[model samples]
Target: MRKMILPPPPLFSALQQPAQHLLPYKTRKKGGGGRESARSSRRPQYCRDPAVHNALYTGDLQKIKSIFKDETTANLIIDSLAEELVWSAELGLWVLAPQKTHTSPLRITVSRGYRDCVKHLLLQGADVDAIVGGKAALHDSCANHRAECTRLLLNYSANPNILSEEGLAPLHLCTTQESLPCAQMLLEYGALVNQNTRDRRASPLHVAAKHGLDDHVKLYLCYGANIGHRNREGETALNSACASADKPEEAGRYYRVVKRLLESGADAQIAGRKNHTPLHNACSNCHIRIVELLLQHGADVNVSNCAGYTPVDCALHAVEDYLEGEPEKLIATLLNHGAAPINPKMLKFCVLSPRTMEVILNTYDRILSCDSWVEFVPSEVWQEHHVFYDSALCLLNQPRALQHLARCAIRKQLGIRCHQGIAQLELPSSLQEYLSLSLEGYLK
Candidate 1:
């Protein structure tokens, strides 16, 4: 290599001597120690010549090769050549010798879809299963919805079902990215639809349902994916779809799939970690139509989970317009069909009413304070003084008042009864308190 010394600094000769003298005096006064010389060498060197990286950055690879013919320029330009090569490769604009960052030259081409690159790189001996960023290159192509690239890669023996670092396979990646074309291609290429991730034990259907992708869902169903396959938590994909109804577009799609799943005989009663079924999940999200669809398919509405929350409880917890009174309607339907009521908040608050009080107190084994029970009254009802009986009335077990105690709960749950017989009853203070909270929480 020919040696070339960097040119010496040009001088302002008249000020140079004076500046040198001033430097020493200023250093002492300003605390600028001689250690500053070490700092000067710490910064990176910037080569200002545009010709060096310009061709590479701009994808002018032919021009770049010509510049490299001059040995001095090549030596100066080598530092930037790798970046130029990588950028050009990523852009699919030109070919170059493998640079440092990509020493193995796994050429899953960066642009022009996934197909041609797969064919080209396969001929060049690129590894089909080479891992990049903890993902197989097949995942990148599929997730970007590159159908042809995915197909070509698959033909070259890439694993179609390998899980990425995120525990997502090409199927899961396609669902999340909403790439219907790539997902369809994956299925065509023998990708497993019911494949489970160890993390969620969630199948490809579940991933699609969670994100509410309609076409991915349909593709899975068409390919004989078990729509009822539950995750590790025992929740099915339909359950996820019902619970994740965040947007109208998603909600509508979820409903259509739920209808399809039901018609196809997928079970709606499969429970999750807390023993919550699809009905419970729908109620939690306040989807009246979904709740109705679940019930129409013979779902149990009053089934309580391990945490004492029923589909009724979940529905009552929601405040959306269509969701109002859903839990009540479902509960009523189930009750008519012989479902027994569970321990209720009304019973919890009504200690004086002996009818169901014994049963309620027996379940708890101890009285939870009057104040605690009183707190169950909705804030709106409490502010309105709906439950105003004397402290003495609460002291004794009042059995005759049982009919009266049930009134508030009935009214709060079903709305005010207009019948003269119902309006005639004098509800107890405890019962009224129960009514207040139930109504407040429900109305809210």
Candidate 2:
């Protein structure tokens, strides 16, 4: 497959030759084993001549005025990373590397939040659309959260949708709280609210949800952003929110994003690349609150992904400790929502989670056998929670208690409406709790 190459912005034409001259001229070696020998494996260093780089990076307005006296000097591309050390696999050694990145003075000033220098550069004829390192001045300013610089550049007619080298639009680069204002400015200036990245084809909403930026998500939705837009992987913003969260502490924020997306008519049942629904992702990631919310919003409890793994299968595959609270609550919720029973052999996966095992056991009236159930439990976990497992093992081949039998019958009768049905039942609190499959961490 051929990769599409984006042509550099027309603004780059002004700096191509002069930028090369800005590089510190390397003097030739005089002796055989002298300069050339030393240079063969040395890094090319960028010299920050006070007259040029000093004024730009430090926001020295007077110095910049004196240095960039003409239009040509104002557009001279500076070398930010002239050289670096990188591994050379063919040579089997680390080598000094020269990278080609013609950074514009406008990019440097705006990226560093040097508003005065940036304004002066723009006034002195700096091309606001200049492509530096594959990103325009607007992208650099927005990425660094420089609101003032961003506003100035936008006022100068910077292209809001210019694709960076990585194919991310300027709006896609706004991934932090500080970048919110920049995003707003871009939108106010007519940035495409539903524009997607060239790589992931992910809209700004997908990026916002994946990063748990509730404010950004809200802002995008308010601007008529597509709630059901899927990325390259076919994941909607809701799917991205559930699947991309990596920290347990961030669950609350992602929850809000999911709720907002759902409230705005985002499809909770939208399947992504692997045929994994939002519920499947929520279960796999052990997000109990999200799992319940998704289910309550009509997420399919028994739908399987492309891998033939149902939401229950995903729950079984979750890390016991990662569920934040009781892992059994989720299993119970699935069972109440009409999820299929666990295969006896798969009970081995729950041995480490005593409460979860109890919940699954209570849903069944009786087990036909106990040999696999007993052998599947690891010796150490079994020893650690002997009280729970021992009691559970005892009931393996025996008939369940009459009370448990009644609970199973009621649950089976209620079926899919079991969750809401039990809530309205005029039963005692203990009975209501029993019907809801509340965890006792032990089999009765």
Candidate 3:
């Protein structure tokens, strides 16, 4: 067996003689404590000491204690840089743009989960609340999910509500499922549950909802987190849950988040800056179950956003993006609740979605024109589902089947009560299924 030989530390050779340049300085007085405020426009001049850096990063407790026996060594702040070349618009050239970070041993230990070394550094008088490159020891501990390190820091009187240089509290830093324990500790230690970010003004609940952290959201609500608190965008926890799911399959997790929020008194119809309700957001994301839940909670199916696009329109727009997720069903659900029909001009948009076209055509009694709709679908997609598209195009100048006409008449009479009225009409199950717009890939 061969042992792996790692490269030597960047500062190993420089530490032979006293590296006076790496000693701690008052970053606050110099206005250079954080990476963003100080390093935004210009790079900072700095150096690193390998002995302490190695000990902290590697969780070497004995090594940390040996050097930190000298109090000054434990509190030293080191500067590190990430080298990269980026285009500088002002310079009009690609420049060697480096990101400089000034961090302390306590922050590094907590971030890397070096629990014992963190305790040793604290015993040596390390500032538990020390800010390094925009984050404090507590912020790093929570962000990195270092539970024990977080407890030690909190026990040392670290401020759980201390805002990072980016203006995020430690509670907001707990974005992952593993960070739930850290968040619990922060909340128990008096962290504000509804603290909003400075830029987005999103609360901790918003963060948890967006990231799909079920336990984190539950814990916050248990601690009396305000469910109705809206962000700068007027998005409550429910809105965030519906809008933040990036994948169709991932929508289920966010759906659960929205369900919990609603159970806790989150309003479903509180629109955001764009007046987009939770239903609009859910339909746009192709979340059938979420859309159903919002509707059941009395969400207005016909409510339009600032852009004048209703939830039905949102569902159509989501069709191509979520082809595998059955977006057509979302449109059917909206229509059953008396949502306005799809725009005739937009019929072309659903060319790739034949089943969606079937649902819409079944809703109308008059014959639909499809002469121009054929041109909307690409040749390849049309060729792939020719049977369905052909039958769809045939209905352009012809009246729909008698069954569909009956469905249209019954639905129109029931109006908004179409969904519930048909359920208890005492009709056969097959007749009930027909009125609910069950998919057939064709109108007849």
**Which model scores highest in TM-score?**
3
List TM-scores for all candidates, in order. 0.54, 0.86, 0.88
Name the candidate, 1 or 3, with the larger lDDT value: 3
lDDT at position 84, candidate 3: 56
**Candidate 1 clashing pairs, residues 3+ apart or interchain:** 114-149, 115-149, 377-437, 378-436, 378-437
Q: On a 0 to 100 scale, what is the lDDT of residue 84 in model 1?
A: 25
Q: Would you list the rank order by lDDT, best first?
A: 3, 2, 1
lDDT of 1 by residue, 204-224 (tens): 888888887777777888999
Q: Which ten residues in a row have the lowest lDDT in candidate 2?
A: 33-42
Clashing pairs in 2: none
Off by over 4 Å in 1: 1-119, 176-178, 320-444
Q: Could you tell me the TM-score of candidate 2? A: 0.86
lDDT, residue 205, candidate 3? 95
lDDT of 3: 0.79
RMSD of each: 18.7, 10.1, 6.6
Estimate every model's Cα lDDT from 0 to 1: 0.54, 0.79, 0.79
